[model samples]
Every structure is written in structure tokens, then in C-alpha cells.
Target chain A: MRQNRFVEKSIEKLLFVAAAIATISVALITIFVFRSGLPAMSGYGFANFLFGADWSPGNGEYGILALTAGTLAVTFLALLIGIPTGVCCAVFLAEILPKRAAAVFKFAIELLAGIPSVVYGFFGLIVIVPIISEHVLPLWQRVNPDAQTTGLSILAGGFILAVMILPTIVSISENAISSVPQDYREASLAVGANKRETIVRVLIPAAKSGILASIILGMGRAIGETMAVMVLTGNVAMLPKGILDPVATLTGTIAMEMSYAGPTHQEALFGVGIVLFVIILILNLAAQAIARKMGAVGRE
Target chain B: MNRKLGDISFYGIVLILSLATLAILIVIIAYVMRQGLPHISWEFLSQSPEHMGREGGILPIIVGTVFVTLLALAIATPIGVGAAVFFAEYSKEGRVVQVIRTFTEVLAGIPSIIFGLFGFAFFVVFMQMGWSILSGGLSLSLMILPTIIRSTEESLKTVPLSYREGSLSLGATKWETTVKVVLPCCRKGILTGLILGIGRAVGETAVLYLTIGGSIRIPTSLFDPARTMSMHMYMMTAEGISREKSFATAALLIVIILIVNSIANFISNRMKGAQ
Candidate 1:
């Protein structure tokens, strides 16, 4: 009995050690990135580094203002396109569709999530870029004959990201929608409300926290995404005058230059990473808090 | 009559939008298959490239992908399962659990590129592992750690408390019951979690590309530089070389992802039914 007790205690301790690995890693990543990047940000002047327009490493200019604008623009545009479509799909799956059809749709969403981002980037490169170049660019040119774009622009990046984040939003929102108590729906019907009315009035409002959580998570994804936007946006460091104009993102800038960056340049890239990290961390905490609230309400 | 018409049209619009969502995936697959199918000869799969992927096959790249992915799972499985076990069994509602769970969520929210930066700065530069299969696999292990833990914790949650009670009443200790009784019951769920983690690690391009040294050779050891299939595809497109091979790689990647997703779904379904 004593030996068994010893064994049990040791095993628990071992598991504790194992569990600490993730905590340690999170600490290490935060420390190393900040340690490496903070100096460059300070030396470069926080204002200059954050709000400068030019980003030429060769010239020692490390302004990320344009990248910040470009990232926000792309993320905002993606949320605009993704949220409505994804909610519609979720509502269809949760409230409207039959079980078997919903199963098929869920499979597709899983498949969508499973496909690599690089492949999505590839699809963007070959498929979306050409369509924009040929079809959309011509429309711009018709308005202003001097207008030119290779079709790799902020819009293309946003479109690809919207498609990429669809699975995240739809799956989560569908779960939130379906998990609303059946009594809510039945009560609406008892009060002479139609199926549509129940879903629109009660189901959506009750599930808003969850749906909002999904959107925040999706927003984090859109902001952090690197390869797809890197391949889609023309990687121009200039602030885009319009969606059709090319621009660089924070992740894109780091990715494009990290392979061969000098010391200062490397530091600046890490600085870019710090910016990206803080934004995502905020979004993650927000999503988690909202999710926790939703869970608490569900239990009550 | 107008209310009925409104309901009909609302349902119609939702169905159309849902179908449109499905059509997007179909079109992408069709387009890729159309471009990539002709390039999938046996020789293309078996041979090594001659001129930086402009001339030959992707055998080495495939081998690198398998080796790196398996290595990552090897490292991630133990730690993730252990953490999940701890969370399910030993841990209580307190500050430590809160901290750990928060950090894991933070870790998950982290971008792969940031992971790339961390891997580059720490493993490659600080640890002096240098760009190799070891560094790449180690870095990827952290990236997939959250997925494995969440899924395993989920399955662990499904294990009935009565099983442990029975084991303890019969003189088995907590560790023994957890090992012999509790774990075996949820092996399928654990397997599903590992497969899901594998799915996350396999097609990863951004993380591996930063740490793996981007070589197109079969790595003979953990210290050797190598490139995975995803990296190969990304390079082909990024460098503007070999469109046919790029699509072929993308097609194979999609095929692998589909298989992994289906397997995970199948196992989870069976696990639920058995429970």
C-alpha cells in the first residue's frame, strides 16, 4: 500500500512537470521575442518605428505605419465579408437544415479547416489573383484609364482570408446557435412566433456572446495570417491608397526579410512580431472571457 | 400569405448561401485537380529533384515531411497527454490551472509566424540547434501542443468516474487505475487527438520553413537540414518556379488533409457511439 502510494504521488508530480512545459514555452517565447525586439524599438524611437511610412532595411528605415494600416485594412475587410456569410451558413446549419444535410456541410467545413494555409495561398495566387487582375482591374481601368494593378492587392488578400476564416466562424457560431435551449425556440412558438422569428429574435440575441467570440477569434486569425497574404498582396511596403493598391503587412514584412536580415533588421522584424503578438493576445483574451461568460450563462 | 412568402424566401436565401459555401470548396478542388492530375506520375513521386525543383521529383521532400511530422508527434504526444491527464485528474480549480490554461490559449492564439520567430531566435540561434529536422520538429511540437491537450482533455473528461472508483475499491491506486483502466477506455479518443495534431503539423509551412533550413534533400539524421512538402509547394510558388509541380504538391496536400480529417471524424464518431 505504501509503495502504491509512492508510485501514485510520483506519477502526479511527473505529470505536473509535463504540464509546466507549455507554461515555460509561452514564457520563453514572450521573453525572447520582447528581449530581442524591444531594444530596436527603443533605439529607433517608438513613434518612428510605429508610424514611419518607409520600411527599407537597406536604408535603416523601419517604419511600420503602412504595414499596420494594411493589416487593419485587410482584417477589417475580411471580417466584413466573412461575418455575414458565415452567420448565414451557421443559421442554415443549426436551425434550418435537416440533420443529414447539416452533416455534409459540417464535413466540408472540417475539410476547409484542414487544408493548409499555403494551399490557400497557392489558390489565391493562381485563382483569385488572375480573376482580380483580369476582371476587376479592368473595371478600375475603365473608370481611370491610367489605373494599373497586377491583381495582387489588399483586396485579394482580404478575399482569401475571408474564405480561410469561414470554417472557424461557421462551426463555432453553429455550435452557439444550436446550443441555445430548445425551450427558447418552443416558447417563441408558444407565443405565436414563427420559426424564423424565433431564430431571429431570441436565438441570435441569446447566442450573441458566442457568435462574437467566434468573430474575435476569426479576427485574430486574419490578423496573424502570414503566408496567404504574403503570397496575395504584392508585398509593397507603401501604404495603399485603395484596396486595389499593393501593401505589405506586419507578418509579410517579417517573412519577406527574415531569411537574410542583418542584426538591426532582424530586431525590427521581432518588433513587428511583438506588435502582432500583442494584438492577437488581446483578441484571444477577449474571446476567452466572452466564451466563459457564455458558458456560465448556459449552466445557469 | 405575405408571412408565408417571407418564410419561403428566407429559407430559399439561406439554402442558396449554404450551397454557395459548398461550391467554393468544390471549385477549388476541381481547379487544383485539373492542373495537378497530369503531373502525378510514379517517377514524379519517386525521384529527387535535379535542378532545385525545376527538373525532377519530390521524394526527398516527402520523406522530410514524414520524418519531421513524426518527430513532432513523438515529442508532443507525451507532454500533451500528460498535461491533459493532470488537468483531468490531479488538478483543482486554482491559480495554477488558470495560469496554465490561459497560457495555453495564448499559445494557441499566437501566429505561426511568431512561432517561426521564436523558433528562429531560440532553437536555431540560442540553442544552437541550427536549421535542421530537430529544431523544426521541436518548434512544431509546441505549435500542435494545444490541439493535442484540448482533445485529450476532452476525451479524458468523458471517462466515467465510476471506473476509477471501481478500480480504487479493488485496491488499485490512482496511478494504476488511470493507466490501466481510464486510459484504455479512451484510447480511441486519444488516437483521434493525435491524428488531429498530426493533421495540424503535416501541412504547416510557415513554422517549418523558418526552422527547417529549406533543403530539398532526405535528412539522414535529426541534425540534417530538410524541407517538407508544404515548404516545397510554398517555395515553388514564392520563387515563381514550376507551376505544374506546385499544383501537384497542393493536390497531394489536399488529399492528405481529407484523409486525416475523415479518419479523425470516423474515430470520434465511433468513440461517441461506444460511450
Candidate 2:
């Protein structure tokens, strides 16, 4: 009996140890990044680093204003393109498509999500960039012929990011729509409402929070992406004059410089990471709150 | 009536949009193959990277990525599933388990770049491991552990309660019943989690870029710095190399992940049938 009791105690202890280790991993990382990034923060002070306009690592001045702007620009552009399309795709799958076909489409999107970011970067480089340079850029240039940038602009990067985030938004929004229940759809249809009207007015309004949460999740992915945008964005750390101009992002800045960055340079890069992480953390918290609200009202 | 026509049009739009999703996969595959296949060669697969005029292959990068991911899965699977077992079987009350579960969920939601930053700061710097493979694998193990545990818990929950009752009736202890009956019943689900974890580890790029310093040559040991295939592709593309080699490597990685995923799905389905 004593031996059995000992074994049970050990099992509980083991569980505690495992959970502790997991949490420690995340915590230690946050602390260490802050520690390493301290030197740069001291050197430039927070206001200058955050608000200054130039980012020339060679001459010892490092301002992230343009990089932050570029990051926000690409993220906003991606959300703009991906949200409407993803919602339409989700609604169509949930309300209109045949079951088997919808299953195939969902499977395809999931697989697309599974593909590595490196592969996405490779694909964008070979296929998307050329299409932009050869066809899209010239058309835009016709309006502004003297525009110095030919390709590798924020628009191209934003388009690629939209493609990457599409699957995430579609899947999440599909679940939102599906959770609306058959009874609601049936009641709307029984009241002489056409399928389109029922979907737009009845189904969408019912799951608005979840659909909004899906778009927020897409924003997280867009802001966090590195390799694809890094490859296509031309890495010029200046605020984009227009959507067609070149720019850099926080993720891209860290990735491009982390390897060769000097002590101050490396610390500045870590600061970029900290800023990016905080943004994503806040976004995720908002999404989780929205999701919870959605569930509570959904039950009611 | 106009309403009836509107219903038909809605259905038509849904069909077209749904088919378009599948069309994306077709377009991606077509693009990858068109750009990648012609350049694939045995030498390209076998050789190492080159800087100036030399022709390079992906031998080291492929091996390094596989080795690191396999090592991480080895360490993470037992602990993750063990925690899941404890939560599902042993936890009688509420708040502590709820907190632990929430933490795991938050960990899963944290971006890979954050994981990379954490790995870099803690594993690489605080631990003084100096961008070695072991540090990187440890970081990745933590990153994927949440996914494995959640999926395992879901699968364990699906195992019918009757099996546990039957085992207890036969004079078995809780541990014995879990080990013998419940574990066997949920083997397919557990395997699915492992497979998904593997896919995440194999495809991961951002974390590796920070934790594992990009060195193209083969690592002599786990403590050595290594470059993964994804990292290699990132480096190559960033350097503005011609698209041929980069595309070939990308295609190769995609094919490898597809095969692994399909095989995993097949095994799990077979296990489901056997049970």
C-alpha cells in the first residue's frame, strides 16, 4: 500500500515538473531578450529609437520609424485583401456549396497552411515577382511613369501575405458560420428570405464577432511573417511614399540583420522582436476575448 | 420569383468560390513543378552549398533539419503526452488544471518569431550554448509541445468510458487500465498529434534562423551550429541567387512534408480501423 502511494505521489510530482519546465521556457526567453536589448535602449533612449526617421546601421544611427510604418502598411494591406475574400469563401462553403466539394476545399486550404514559409518565399520569388515586374508594375507606372520603383514594392509583399493568411481566415470564419446552427438558417428561409439575404443579414450578423476575430488572427500572421516578405520586399528601410515604393518591416529587419549585427545593432534587432511580440500578444488577447464573447452570446 | 433566382445564384457563387480554393492548390503545385523539376539533379541533392561560382547541393541542410526535428520530437512527446494523461485522468478538481491548460493554449498562440527571440535570448545567450543545434532543438520542443498535448488530450477524451469500467471490474488499477486499455484505444489519435508536431518542426523557419546559426557545412555533433533546409532557402533567396536552385530545394522540402503527412494519415486511419 505504501509503495503504491509513493508511485502516485511521484506521478503528480512529474506532472508538476513538466508544467514548470514548459512555462520556464517561455518566461526565460522574454527576460533574456529584454536583458540583451537593454544596452541599445540606453544608448539611444526610447523616444529617439522609436520616433527617429533614419535607420542607417553603418553610421551608428538606428531609427525604426520607417520599418514600423512599413510593417503596419503591409499588415493592413494584407488584411484588406484577405478578409473579404476569406469571408466570402467561408460563407459560400458554409451556406451554399455541396458537402463533398466543401470538404475538398477545406482540405486544400489546410494543406496550403501546412506548406513551409520558405517554399512560399521561393514561389513568390519565381512566379509572383515576375508577374509584378513585367505586367503589374508597368500598368501602375503608366499613371505615374517616372515612379522610380519598378517592382518589389509594398503591394507585391502585401499580395503574397494575403495569399499566406487566406487559409487561416477561411478556416476560422467557416467554423464561425457553421456554429450558427441550422435552425436559424431554416427560420430565415421559411420567412421568404432568399439564401443570399438570409446569409448576409441573418447568418453573418449572428457570428460577426467570430468573423472579426478571424480577421484579427489574419492580421497577426501578416505582421509576424518573415521569409516571404523578406525575400520580396527589397529591404530598403524607409517609409513607403506610396504602395508601389520599397520598404522594410520589423520581422524583416530582425532576420536581415541579426546574423551580422554588432553589439548595439543586435540589441536594436532584439528590440524589434520585442515590439513585434508585444503587438501580436495584444492582438491575440483581443481575439481570445472576442471568441469568448462570441461563445457566451452563441449559447444565449 | 426573384427570391428563388437569388437562392440559385448564391449556390452558384458558393460552388465557384469553393472550387477556387482547390484551384489554389493546383496553381501552387503547377508553379512549383514548372520552376523546380528541370533543375533537380543527383549532384544537386548530394553536394553542399557554394559561395561564388561553385555548384551546391542540399545534403547537409536536409540532414541537419531532420536530425534536429527528430531529436525535438523524441524529447517533447513523452512529457507532453504525460501531462495530457495527468490532466485527463488524474485531475479531480478545476482551477489548477484550467490554468495549466490556458498556459498551454497561450504558448500555442505565441508567434514562432517570439519563440525564436526567446530561444535566442535564453537558450543561445543565457545558457551559453552559442547557437548550437541542441539549444535550437530544446527551443523547438517547447514550441511544439502544446500542440502535441492538446491533440493527445482530445484523443484520450474520445476513448469510451466503458473500457475503463471494464478494466476496473477485472481488478486493474487506474494506471494499469490507462496503460493497457485506454492507451491502445487512442493510439491513432496520439499518433496524429505526433505527426502534426513533426510537420510543424520540419517546416519551422523563423525560430531556427535565430537559434541555429546559419552554417552550411555539416555539423560534427549536436553541440555544433547547423543550418536547416528552410534556413538555407531563406539565405539563398535573400542573397538574390538565381531562382532555379532555390525553387528546387523548396519543391524537395514540399514533397518530403507531403509524403510524411500522407503516411501519418494512412497509419492513423489504419489504427482506427484496427481498434
Candidate 3:
């Protein structure tokens, strides 16, 4: 009996160590990234690193304004393409589809999410990049004859990112829409509003916070996506003047050049990583706050 | 009449948007299949690269991917399951548990590239693992930990409290009850989570890119550097070398992911049916 108690106690302790690993890993990552990344920023001067436009690492210039702008441009473009379509699809699954059909659609969306990011990058590289450079660029080039163009452009990255984030948005928004209470729907209908009106007004308004949470989560995904953007974004370290121009993202720069980079350049890549980490951390905290608010509302 | 028209148009727009999303999925699959299906052959699956991954097969890359993935899962499963067990059975809704939960959430949301950076700095460079399978596997294990814990906790929650009470009344300790009564019931859920973790680990590219060393040879030891299929595909596409081989590799990756996903779905569906 004493042996059994000892075994049980040891097992409990073992499990506690295992559980604590998550917290330890996060702390290590935070410490390591900042420790490696901060010195380079301080050496380069914080304002120069953050606001300088040039990224010529060979000459020791490490301005990341263009990269930050590129990340914002592509992510914003992705949101422009993803949010409305994702919300509508979520509503269709939650309210419009029959129960059996909704389940099937939900499963398909999960499958969509399951497709690897590299495969999306491959598809974008072969299919979307060609279409943009060959067909779309010709039209735009007629207006600005000297515009540099490539198959790999911001548009391709944005489109692939939009698809990549669709599942995140759709799944979360569907849950949000479905959790808006059946009484809210019936109440809206009881007041002589049609199905569309109820959805547009009462159900959507009630679920707005949750849907907003999903959008924020999707933004996190879009901003941090690496392989797809690395493949399709052409890795140009310039400020993009239009969607058709190729631009380097912070994530893309890290993945593209980290392998062959010099010591200073490598640290700069980590510096890019620091910027990315802070952005994603802020976005995640906002999403969590919104999700907690939604949970409280649900409990009430 | 105007109100009815508005309703009709709104419905049409939503329906079109939904169909468009589905259409994108279908088109991507179809396009990849069209480009890649003819290139997949027995030879392509069996041979090693001849001209920098352009002229030969992907056997070495395949072997490397499997080695790293299996090693990652081996490292992740026990720790992840243990963590889940702790969260489900031992921990209360206290400050410690709350902090752990927040940490896991943040871990899940951290970009794979950031993970790559951390892996490079801490494991490969600092620890002198030097871009080996061990470094990649350890990094991937960290990345997939949250997925495993979340899914396992979810499954563990489905186990009835009555079973624990019954076990305890029969002179079993809390740990014994968890191991014998509760865990047995949620084994399927645990399995489902494992499958999902495998799927993500197998498909991961960015974190592996820095830590895995991007070598196209089979890793004979844990410390040997290796390149995964996703990394191979990324390199091929990015460097504009061997588009045909790249397509073939992408096809294989998609097929692998689809199989893993289907199995995961099947397990969860079976669990639901059992309930």
C-alpha cells in the first residue's frame, strides 16, 4: 500500500513537470528572441532600424520600414479579400444550411485548414503568379509603361494568405453566429423581420464581438505566414507602390535569407523576428480579450 | 417589392461567396493534381537526387521527413499527454492554471518563423546542436504542444465524473482513477489529438527550415541534418529549380496531409458515434 502511494505521488509530480514545460518554453522563446535581437537594434540605433527604408545588409543599413509596410500591405489586402467572404460563408453554415449540410461544409472547411501552407505556396507559385504577371500585369503596364513586374507579387501573397486564413475566420465566426441564442433569432422574426433582416440586424449584431475576434485571429495568421509569402512575394526589399509590385515581408525576409546571412545580417533577421513577435503578441492578446468578453456574455 | 428584391440579392450574394470559398479549395486540388499526377512514379519515389534535386527521386527527402516527424512526435506525445492529464485531473481553476492556459494560447499563436528563430538561436547555435534533426524535432515538439494539450483536455473533459467517483470509492487514488478509469474512456480523443499533432508536425516548414539544415540526405543519426518534404518543396520553388519535382513533392505532401486529416476526422466521428 505504501509502494502504491509512492508510485502515485511520483506520477503526479512527473505530470506537473510536463505541464510546466509549456510555460518554460514560452519564457525561453521570449528571452532568446529578445536577447539575440535587441543588441542589433541598439547597435543600429532604434529609430534607424525601425524607420529607415533601406535594407542593404551588406552595407550595414538595417532599416525595416519597407518590410513593415510590406507586411501591412499584404495583410490588409488579405483582410480585404477574406473578411466579407469568410463572414458570409460562416453565416451560410450557421443559419442558412440545413443541419446535415452544415456539418459537411464544416468538415470541408476543416480539410481546407488541413492543407499545408507549403502546398498553398506551391499552388500560388504555379497558378496565381503566372495569371497575375501574364494577364493582369499587361493591363496595368499599359498605364505605367516603365513599371517593373513579376509573376511573384504582393497580390499573389495576399490571395494565398486570404485562402489560408479563410478556415480560421469561418470556423470561429460560425461558432460565434451559432452561439447568438436561438431566442435572438425568434425575437427578431417575431417583430416581422425577414430571415435576411434578422441575420443582418439582430443575430449579426449580437455576434459582432465574436466575429471581430475571428477577424483579429485571422489577421494574426496572415501577418505571420512565412513559407507561402516567401515563395510568392519575390523577396524584393523595397516599398511596394502597388499590389502588383513585389515586396519583402518581415516573416519572408527571415525565412528567405537567414540561412546564408552574415552574423550581423543574421541578428537583423532576429530583429525582424522581434518585430513580428511583438505584433503577433499584441494581436493575440486583443483576440483573447475579445474571446473572454464573448465568453462572459455567453455565460450571462 | 424593393424589400423582397433586397432579400433575394442578399441571399444570392451569400450563396455565391460560400460557393466561391469551396470553389477555391476544389480548384487548388484539381490544379495540383493535374500538374503533379503524371510526375509521380515508382522511380520518383525510390531514388535519391542526382542534379541538386532536379534529375532524381525524393527518397532521401522522404526518409528525412519521416525521421524528423517521428522523433518530434515521440518527444511531444508523452509530455503533451502528461500535461493534459495534469490539467484535466489535478489542476484547479487557480492562478497557476490560468497562467499556464494563457501561455499555451500565446504559444499556439506565435508564428512558426519566430519558432524557427528561437530554434536557431537556442537549440542549433547556442546548444551547439548545429542544425540537426534533434534541433528541428525539439522545435516542432514545442510548436505542437498546444495542439496536443487542447485536444487532450477536450477529450478528457468528455469522461464522466461518475467514473472517477466510482474508482475512488473502490479504494483507488486520484492518479489511479485518472489512469485507469478516466483515461481509458478518453483514449480515442487522445488518439485524435495525436493524429492532429502528427498532421501539423509533418506539414510544418518554417521552423524546420532553420533547424533542420536543409540537407537532402538521409539522417543516419539524431544529430544529422535533414530536410523535410515541405522544406524541399519550398527550396525548389524559391530557387526556381526543378519545377516538375517540386510539383511531385507538393502532391505527395498533400496526399499525406489529406490521409492524416481523414484519419483524424474518422476517429472523432467514431467517438461521436460511440457517444
Candidate 4:
């Protein structure tokens, strides 16, 4: 009986240690990144490292303005397309589609989400990039005539990101829309509103927080997406002159150069990692807040 | 008439957008299948590469993927399950738990590329692990830790309190109940979480690329650097090495992802049905 108590005590201690792993890792990652990265940010002058446009590490210039702009531009473009298409699909699945068809489409969406980002990158590299350069680039070139491009641009990366984030947005938004109280729909219909009117005015308005949460979450995903953006967008560290112009990303640059980069150059890349981390952290907290709000709204 | 037209057009737009999304999925999957499905064979599955993945099977790459993935899961499962068990069974809903939960959320929100950078700096460099399967596995284990914790904890919650109370009434200790009655009830759910973790680790490229040293040869030890199918496919296409072989590898990767995903979906769905 006493030995049984001992067995129980040891297991509890072990579980406590296990639960502490995440807490410990969170501390370790924070320390490691900032410890290695901040010195370089301070070395190059924080403002200069951040706002400088040139990222040619060989020349001792580690400005991340170009990559920051690239990540933002691509994320913005992805959300621009993804939000509308995703919300519409969400609405379609939640309100309009037959339940049987919705289930199949929902399964398909899950599969889309499950497909690895690496394959998404490879697919974009092979199929989407050429389509953009060959089909989309010519129209823009005809309009601008001075454009230099290989179809690898913010447009390319943004398009792939839009596709990559579609499942996330659609699945999440659908849940939000579906969670709107059935009574709202019934009351709206009984009070002379049409089905579309009820959905547009009442359901969507009610589900707005969840949908917004989905968008924020999708934006976080787009910002975090590395392989797909790296493959589709040409790795040119320049502020994109336009959607047609080539751009490099923070994640892409880190993945590409971290291997052969000199020690100083590596620290600057760590600086890049720090900036990306701050942005993602902010977005993540925002998403969590909105998602919490959505839960509260659902309870109401 | 104008309002009717507008409403009809709105519905039309919704249908078109939905179809367009589906079309994109179909196009991507179909394109991969069309390009790569014919190239897979028993020989391609069994033989080692001859020259930079251009003239041989991907047996070594497959082996590397299994090795690194297993090591990562092995490291992560215990820690993750332990954390989850603590969160589920032991901890009160307190400030500490909230802080821990918030940190876990932060970890979840972090980009994998940042994970790769940290892994490169911490595991590969500072820890003197170098770019090996161990480094990659260690790094990847952390990347998947939050995932395993979140999923496993959720499952553990689904085990009813009555079950625990029943075991307690039967003179079982807390640990004994958690290990015997509560865990058995949620083993399927735990398995689902594990499969999802496997899917994430097996498909990961950024962290592995930085930490694994990307050797295509068959790994001889835990310290030996190796490449995953994701990295292999990325390299072949990026370097323009061999299009057909890259396509084959991509097909195989897709196949593996499908299996992993299907297994996860099947388990979760079964759990749901049981509930």
C-alpha cells in the first residue's frame, strides 16, 4: 500500500516535468533567438537593419526592408483573394449547399488542408509559376511594355499562398457561419426576409467575429508559409516594384542563405527571424482573441 | 427586378467562387497524378539512388524519412503525452495553466522557418549536435510538440470524469486510473494525434533542410545527416536535376501524406461516431 503511494507520487512528478517541456521550450527558443539575433540587430543599428533595403550580406549590408515588404505584400495579396473566395465558399457550404454535397466538399477541403505545403510549393513551381509568367505576365507586359519578369513575382507567391490558405479559411469560416443560432434564421425568414437576405444580413453579421478570426489565422499561415513562397517567388531581395516584379521573403532568404552564410551574415538572418517572429506573434494573439470572442458570441 | 437580379447575381457569384476553389484543388492533385503516377514502381521503391537522385530508386530517402520521423515522434510522444496528461488530469485551471496554455499557443503560431533557424542555431550549432538526423529529429520534435499536446489534451478531456471517479471508487490511485481506465478510453484519439504529428513531421522541409544536412545517402547512424522526401523533391526541382525523378518523388510524398491524413481522419471520425 505504501509502495503504491510511491508509484503514484513518482508518476505525478513525471507528469509535471512532461507538462513543463512546452514551458521550457518556449523559454529556450525565446532566449536562443534573441540572444543570437539581437546583437546583430544592435551591431548594424536597429533602424538601419530594419529599414535598409539591400540584403546583400557579402557587401555587409543586412537590411530587411525588402523581405519585410515582401512578406507583407504577399500576405496581403493572399488575403485579398483568399478572404472573399473562402468566405463565399464558407457561406455556400454552410447555408446554400445540400448537406450531402457539403459533406463531400468539406472533406475535400480537409484534404486540401492536409496536402503538405511542400507539395503546394512544388505544384506552384511547376504549374502555377509558368501559368502566371506565360498567361498573366504577357497581359501586364502589353500594358507596361517595360516589365522584366520570369513569372516569379509577388503575384506568383501570393497566388500560391491564397490557394494554400483556402482550406483553412473555408473550414474555419464555415464553422463560424454554421454556429449562428438556427433561431436567427427562422426569425428572419418569418419576419419577411428572404433566405439570402437572412443569411447576408443576420447570419453573416453574427458570424463576423469567427470569419474575421479565420482571416487573421489565415494571414498568420500565409506569413508563416515558407517553402511555397520560396519556390514561387524568385529569391531576389528587392522591394517589389510591382506585383510583376520579383521579390524575396524573410523565410525564403533565411532558408536559402543560412547554410553558407558567414557568421556575421548568419546573425543578420537571425535578426530577420526576430522580425518575422514579432509579426507572427502579434497576429497569433489577435487570432486567439478573436476566436475567444467568437466562442463567447456562440454561447450568447 | 433590379433587386432580384442583384440577389441572383450574388448567388451566382457564390456558386462560381465555390466551384473555382474546388477546381483549384482538382487541378493541383490531377496535375501531380498525371505527371508522376506512371513513374512509381517496385524498383523505385526498393533501390538506392545512384547519382544525386537522378538514376536510382528512393529507398534511401524513404529510409531517412522513416528514421527521422520515428525519432522525432519517439522524443515528442512521451513529453507531449506527459504534458497533456498533466494538463488534463493533474493541473487545476489556474494562472499557471493559463500562462502555459498561452505559451503553447505562441509556439503553435510560430512559423516553421523560425523553428528551422532556432534549430540551426541551438541544436546544430550551440549544442554541437551538428547537422544530423539527431539535430533534425530534436528540432522537429519541438515543432510537433505543441500539436501533440493540444490534440492529446483535447482527447483526454473527452474521457468522462465519471470514468475517473469510478476507478477512484475502485481503490485505484490517480496515476493508475489515468494509465488504465482514462487512457484506454482515449487511445484512439491519442493515435489520431500521433498520426497528425507524423503527417506534419514527414512533410516538413524547412527545419529538416537546416538541421539534417540534406545528405541523400543512406544514413548509417543517428548522427548521420539525411534528406527527407520533401527536401529531396525541393532539391531536384530547384537544381533542375531530373524532372521525372522529382515528379516521382513528389507523387510518393503525396501518397504518403494521403495515407497519413486518411488514417488520422479515419481515427478522428471513428471517435466522433463513438461519441
Best by lDDT: 3
lDDT per residue for candidate 2 within B36-131, as digits (tens), equals: 777778988888877621357878887889888987899899888887888778776578765665566556666777788778888788789988
Which portions of model 1 show Cα errors greater than 4 Å?
A: A142-146, A296-300
lDDT of 2 by residue, A106-206 (tens): 65676777788888777777777788778877887889887666568788789889888888788878889999989999999999886789898899999
List chain B TM-scores, each candidate: 0.97, 0.93, 0.98, 0.96
User: A169-282, model 3: which lDDT tens digit per residue?
Assistant: 998888899999888988889999999999998888998988988999899999999999888888899999888989999999998889889988888889999999999999
DockQ of 2: 0.56
List the lowest-lDDT window of 10 residues for candidate 2 chain B. B49-58
Q: Sort all candidates by TM-score, best to worst.
A: 1, 3, 4, 2
iRMS per model in Å: 1.0, 2.0, 1.1, 1.5
Report how closely model 3 matches the true complex, as a DockQ value: 0.81
User: What residue runs in model 4 are displaced by over 4 Å at the alpha carbon?
Assistant: A1-6, A296-300
Q: Per-residue lDDT tens digits of candidate 1, residues A1-300?
A: 788688888999999988888989999999999998999999999999998998888999999999998898888889998998889899999998899888888989888888899899999999999999999988888888877889999889999899888888998899899999999999999999999889888999999998998899899999998889999999998888887888899988888889999999999999999999999889888888898888831110
Question: TM-score for all predictions?
Answer: 0.97, 0.92, 0.97, 0.96
Candidate 4 residue pairs that clash: none
Residue B162, model 2: lDDT of: 94
| TM-score of model number 2 | 0.92
TM-score winner between candidates 1 and 2: 1
True contacts kept of 1: 0.80
Instruction: Give each model's whole-structure lDDT.
Output: 0.89, 0.79, 0.90, 0.87
Q: How many steric clashes between backbone atoms does each model show?
A: 0, 0, 0, 0
Q: Flag the better candidate by DockQ, 2 or 4.
A: 4
